[model samples]
Target: MEEDTDFRIRFSSLCFVTDHVGFCGTIKSSPSDFVVIEIDEQGQLVNTAPSKLISKILPEPNNFAKKTKLDLQNLSFEEGSNQEVSIFAGCSGADQYHQSGSEREDTISDGTSKGEEQTVDDLGTLLDEKTNELLNHFACDIKEKWNSKTELIGSSPEFSLGRILDKNQRAILHSAIRQKFPFLITVGKNSEIVVKPNLEYKELCHLVSEEEAFEFFKYLDAKKENSKFTFKPDTNKDHRKAVHHFVNKKFGNLVETKSFPELNYSAGNPNVAITVRFREKTHKHRKRSLFEYQDRKVIYTDDSLRLGQLKGNHFDIVIRNLKNQINDSANLKDRILEAIENVKNKGFVNYYGPQRFGMGRKVHTDQIGLALLKSEMVEAVKLFLTPEDLDDPVNRAKKYFLQTEDAKGTLSLMPEFKVRERALLESLHRFGMTEEGCIQAWFSFPHSMRIFYVHAYSSKIWNEAVSYRLGTYGSRVVEGDLVCLGEDVDDEHFPNNKVHLVTEEEESANTYAIHQVVLPVLGYNIQYPKNKVGQWYQEILSRDGLQTCRFKVPTLKLNVPGCYRQILKCPHNVSYQLKEEHDTDVKMEGSHIDEATLSLLISFDLDASCYATVCLREIMKHDF
Candidate 1:
């Protein structure tokens, strides 16, 4: 299907397949544009449609005091919809319920369901409108400071929360503070309350660049000889190595190290601080190239991919799903066959395609994946609730859930087809509003979906890697490039993970093909290219708030073992013909095809992980 290219290409990795000034065309004029028939590993053509009919009907929950109903199609707040939520639901607290408004009224618990109004105390109370606004503003600032000065964990800066004169309201104030600022430590003494950055809970070190590092050291006034210019110590070995790598890249030869015990040694991590000073004037700088600076460990590509071609039969697929009569448009029907031949022979840039990133979404799926990998469950949940169109009904449901914590009402507003959203809601409803519940809600998704998030995030990086390779080096395979070692081009039994980095041995003999070169998806197990692109991977990952390491969240039990993907892919036996006038007579199941005259029925076969939209995008030279 056609999509908005600007929203998807953040890294600006878009490059063309061939220099063909092709004609323009539109797609997704009708639902027929999304029709895709998948060819399985056994060479059987399978129609790509959800065959399992779903008719899930959920009953009402006891959290809501008012009546609610479900609407499969129209999930609106108006009266004509199938369901209507009369009042907001509260959390798992017995007597505490949230009111839907600017200021939610928290009921006073009298050991019963009776409701009573409460006043805002001198502590950091969010019950009042002004106080809530102030808390939000300061909370954002403190969070930033906490993330930046992560080295000062136990001794973080503190902020006064005024006096909590009433001892009875102190518990209530503490509860409110926890809700707003989870990463904070609170103390009340002699009716005076204060909060500090709870750095022990979170580990964040703002990633820096070479120039930024130089500026940081300069700002510290560490110019004199024997000055201990130390990079912040981290338990995350990957991040430490990344910082060490970049530091060594710039100042390894200039500085001489005198190793000492690791900072925070009692934490049981084998992390050492980069404590060093300028070398003596008599010592000479060691000669080394950029390639010699990479970690000594030899990492290989994912073994799943083989350095070979995919041999398969091709079939016809729709080029563009236009609505109105199109035979009159730009003589497209005449030249489409020629364009098909060009794409079939030359192939297109093997991009991950906009579909992988959740095209048309307000927040891409990969972002949600990144949050999950980072163990930011709340952030992942919020990103998942993001709506493509803010004004749509989905946004209303999201807002309602965020404000009132009403899982049942949110699910009612969500579309029936949204299985993943519904799954999260059901999980929350079953598990209640607890910290464990949030993690369980994340676990409700299928493993394939969980993997897709990380893969999508990596795809963004991979797309950039490919673009840089092609844009910088063009079609020629350069030294330090990687080539898979296999028995035959199509041998399935060969160990595909063993790869040889291009050097004088292969480049001089012209041994490997361009298709054999591969790129990694940025993870712990996967390797990088031997040259600058490999180095670029570490820099990019650090910039994106991670190092190339395993995301082993014990609670989530999620591990993203990275894989390899070939930079380019080709279509098999591509051929095209004009759409028939009588094709409209043949009706598709549950939907009608809008007849168009000038559309092309271009058919081609692509290996798994390849996108048909990209192949068509190459031919059309348009967003479609």
Candidate 2:
């Protein structure tokens, strides 16, 4: 067997020949299995695995023209011969035959020996044919692989050829390979690969470069600059008040402000929306107004702001169907009305809703609040900084780093966009890793967050007190019951003027009308009722190893000057409507009712502090 001495396949080398057909274009891959590309009759590259040519070897090229001409003539040789030679018979633009150690055949298979003589131009023509065939074959293979891999992964595949290439080098090589092969690989600025498809091979090969791909990817990953302002309120301020204060502080004058009704300043759902405008339409006014505020993400802008308010203290809820009866019962409205009246008379439990606690079944904010109340600074810091079980990857990383005592390291790992967390970590780094430092860091968090901890603890106590009061007294106002005077009273005041003890005469006069009884939210100035419900509140406070004075943290100024909350709530403006039943209503068995059955729609409103779901529970008498 003759050896091809001049050419050798090596790692990262471009190979133009394969085992299948002789005319396949270059492939840039590590040597693996024997794959080949061939030129079809239409001058397009085709991938094939012809068994006969698997063992065939091409002679090395001392000269490009001579070597290609010789290889083309040897394309039809019989298998397993030590020195087999073949003719380029019936091949387009070629008419000759060369046998090993023999002269060229004069009469071709087409019965024409004319122009059978070898020429330099013919060699060059063959070389171009081989080059074009190989290039086209390479492009087809790339397209096929790119499409299949992208489909399989549901994204672009990251190409890693070998360990020899560094990240940037690999990206450059990938760009070059994609250009020659006409694949859809896009090299990002950070060397990330993105796949863009259906580009014409010729056009793509000409237009794309490694630098261009890098820039294109960078552009893809670029973040849009926001021209709006954002402001979060202090823990003590309601969202409405916070926005008002923020606008006044920045603009020096109040702008047209529109905001939704604010919820209680609790630990959960603390976001508020508001829009403001400036008198002048200058970028300087917008930019100069911007200030560096920690524990808040603020945006200032000159864009026209349009927002609709979505919150109201009163809600008109429509409940469909009091009873699942299909027939139009004449007393259906009366039944629903009676249910609403029963709820009002019996009184609904005013336990703190799920929003008071942090998300999920387990409440985390209460733990942080308790730690702060007990002056356990280290525990408070840990509880506040660490993420909940359901937190995402970024939060988990921050938690892990903080737990591992890498406080300084956590600053870098923490997201720059999380202003609150960044402020906490920056405080920790500044104060040094001590208990006092931790407390200071905890304090440095958004005032709203700090207040949330205290509020959550108070809510926990309130919830327990309400549960105990309901279980014992069963919603009846007794002699010692503290009834709130009116609905529009704040809960955070000592010697609350809104609450008055229920006298024996008043309790007896309107036994059913006692819908509002006040309970103590334990704090320094709270006067617990001498009644049984107040005893439950004292028991809960004692069980948690807390006293009213414990809430007065002078350093933190988070003193909860105890307040009163109504023990019971009732819905008002009650009304009901009956309509024909739809397919959604589940029918009871053994009931013969036509399709024109009636359904109920009950509408009512409740106080802002009360949950409509709780009111519904009273009417439905089922767990919601």
Candidate 3:
């Protein structure tokens, strides 16, 4: 064996050397310079060998390193100076020691300083080993996790191996890397999880894009030739094949089977809602002239040609015709004047007012009257316009004659007679007037029609006419804790004189009179005195400082069937006044107070006169 002098090297702030030995020949600078180690000490020409080189070799996590320390040391003189150097020692415990400065420093070791430097140098080597071990640990774990040769535990969170993969590492070589899926795929603020396994389908859809999924379902439906599709586990494979074909044909990509079920079941599709608006037009009234009257001082359309749609000239002829028949007398002139004013200003044209024709409150006019006017007009038109007269320019137009004749006939003859008759009768009955035709004719004017319709259409009057009518009453006092009026009180001959007047029998009797009897209408109630009838009578009657007033038995009685009795009596003459009986009945019903009313003790701040007056008004509004 050959002995060599000290040989040294340094890396990552570490330094080391072999033991000193004697060597005869001078070492030459050469590119092929190298240290060779062998089991047989005599094998190589190299004079020295180093264990330091073997210790410096890096452990490979992914693959074994081909180059050894001896190969690195043997580089040629020029090549050594220009060579790329790499350290491969495993990480050591000292590597955890933090560097002194904030900025990173180079890993080069210094060899000149002896004792103090040696400690730091060894520390550097330990640090290098520590770092190498750490890096190797991570790399080995990654390789094992991403081993595609074995099946993965799919449900494990660690299946996402890319999360731990270093940025500098290439992921393409590993098929086991988990695919990334966005948690949300909405254009708006909404979010949803996308777990689709089909890469093609996933690529087509955004995490939020629902359209692609819809299209996928539609494609499935179309593949079935527009047939209604029902999916079962057995058919899933077939369905998946069909889907793959169609998606590939249309989208230039194959879709995975797992996505089919979800896509088919997702919400149908989104639709837009639209709204439209419109505007309405308003209407106005129309008027016409009847005729000229009193030698042209006034006009009259009422007799022959009323202003309603008649030509102006035709109207004038009608006036002349009427005057001619009257011999142009003063009486005729006056009648014509009245007729003209009534038709134009008073709304009497053709016996139907302008107010009655349109949508407004129809001037209540009898259909019968309108029909009569139409018949009159038809007769007049036929009388004046002979076939020869029709040849004149004014009367020559057969169209106008035909149209006007048809209108007149429709107004007069086409309406069902029964309907017209009922309408007229109703109008008359509403006004509380006679429904006789003669009576209707007398009140056929527009003014009268206005009043007639208003009264006819009033709901209150009609309801009452068919209902109970309350009448006047008499004043009486309670006797022996009860002043029982017989159920036959409704019978006109029922004796009220025999019932003892409480006012007359003052000793031990409650003196009561009609302090003010209230009348009430249906569905109403009037307040009454409590069960303490004596206090009611004393307070309502004597409190006013007078014992009595005009006590008269009312002329009418309750028409309703029942044992009607006195339910309550009020002592507060202050609130009592002359009132109708029905009103009192209504007020009593409403308050649950009757002649025998016992619940209330309160009194109104009123005197007998005022109470009587107020009560009377209430009665009129209600009972009467």
Candidate 4:
């Protein structure tokens, strides 16, 4: 309903089509704005027919306008074509423009001039106002259309359709209007719908453009349905369950030693240390740590036996001596026997008593030595062992050190002795004396003996090897663990103090030998002919009768002035002519002999040095 200056172009009598249907007319401008078009029966512009004299035809009255008109002409058909058409007009000149509601109301006041011929510009202004009002209403309606399900954000036209129309929006709108809702209206400046049904309920494949239809179907098929609920198993829960099973089956409620008995198996009470007196054969009396003695012979002593220093290898001797001095009603021999069996099955029978020996202490030695001591004392203890006690203290300790094969296929049972060595070092550090004597006093306990044996052996095996090499200012090691021993030079200049000695017997290694093989090389030989002369070459040279010889001439000096000129100048020389005349006499004399026979006597030495000298001096002498 709007128009622009160029919307309906005027050319004398005809008004070009400007509406969606390009119906032309004989409408002329009367200085007013209304268009009076003359549309034909089919709604096409009526072009003026041509006269006979001008048969070639006047460009057919606005051919450009006619083509555009033809495009819109199909819209007015019986089935209505179901196609929408759009055209543009301007208020100032644009095809579309907005107007305030107040401005639109003021324009409506000119009712009296409605039927009058308004200029094209005046009609365009009115149309723009009406369209703006429709657009506002359309935007509000579009929001209501999507509100229930789509969570619409605004009633503004800007929200109804995006600011710029993309291909998909245009295609969807075009298809939706044509197929689903023919009455659907869009009235905004951009012509976007205000309200429409949600069409997602329909299959996506039905609505997309032909090129995208297959992809849309695949998209729908790929969107999987969600599960109602799910739960992933927790692996931590299983580990805890496994730990629970192990605790129930293996460790029970408390950790008890497999090789030791319950604490109450001794004399109904724990044994405490006792001191005794002894008489010598010379009638001397003395107090001793021995529990039983005869005539000061000290047959049995608590400290010595406990520390594994008891003299005899017989268990009965010690047991009988203990019995001879028992308190009135007790059977001491039986008690001693019971204690022996107790230690044999359990770990500790006698505690390492107060005493010291060797570079370190003998208590440590006793712990290691006593376990392997199968004397009568231990034999007495062994007599009481049941087959079920096969894995008793002695056996278990041996297995821990990997001395016995029983430790295979189980958690590591033997304590790593190095760990014990560090612990002993720490214990020794707390004694506060550097002289090492104080350590000996407290080190003799049976318990210390056990701990020390493990620690000492660890120190011996794991400590660095201390071997020395040569020539270094301090100790030189080719490759071995050793402390750098500082140096001093001897007066004799003999480098004599380089001897390396093993600090401990434990440091020695077993010996073995390896052997190898070697090879040598000798001198060189050369071969040469006795002479430089070639015999077959000389024989050929000697036979001559107007003989020709082919010489290999070098090409390098040929460009020099003398080379080609020398051949010409040779005959021109007087020396060459005289030589020829003098040779005539000799030539005549030699001719008396047969020419073939004389040819053999005409030999020349053909010296290589003489030829080389002549070629060098005459032909190749000049640089140019």
Model 3 — TM-score against the truth? 0.12
TM-score of every candidate? 0.51, 0.44, 0.12, 0.10
Worst 10 residues of 4 by lDDT: 514-523
lDDT (Cα, tens digit) per residue for candidate 2, span 307-422: 22111123333343335234435455565556556775555666565445543322256777888888778777776666644464346656776668677777666543244555
Candidate 2 C-alpha error for residue 16, in Å? 82
Ten residues in sequence with the least summed lDDT for candidate 1:
86-95
- For model 3, how does the per-residue alpha-carbon lDDT over 382-429 read when each residue is reduced to its tens digit? 322222222322223223433553322222322111122223323333
Can you write out model 4's per-residue Cα lDDT over 1-624, one digit (the tens) per residue?
122222112111121111111111111111111111121222222222111110011122210111111122111211101122111010100111122221122122321112122332332332345543453455445435444433222111221332223323332333332222222222222322222222221222223232342332222212222211111122243433443332222212111111111233344422221111111111133222221212222232111122222111210011000121223344433433343333223211010111111122212332332222212222211221111223533335333423322222111332221122222223333542232422321232234333333332222211111000111212211222121122221111111122222233313431110000000000011111111111222332244210122211121111101000000001000000000111121111123222210000000111110111111112111100
Residue 255 error, candidate 3, Å = 59
> Which model, 3 or 4, shows the larger TM-score?
3
Query: Against the true structure, whose TM-score is highest?
Result: 1
Which residues of candidate 3, in runs, are more than 4 Å off? Answer: 1-501, 511-624
Residue 498 of model 2 has an lDDT of 69
Error of 4 at 334 (Å): 64
Question: TM-score ranking from best to worst?
Answer: 1, 2, 3, 4
On the 0 to 100 scale, the lDDT of residue 255 in model 2 is 26
Residue 600 in candidate 3, Cα distance off native in Å? 26
**Deviation in angstroms for 499 in model 1?**
2.7
How many clashes does each candidate structure show, in the order listed?
1, 7, 70, 15
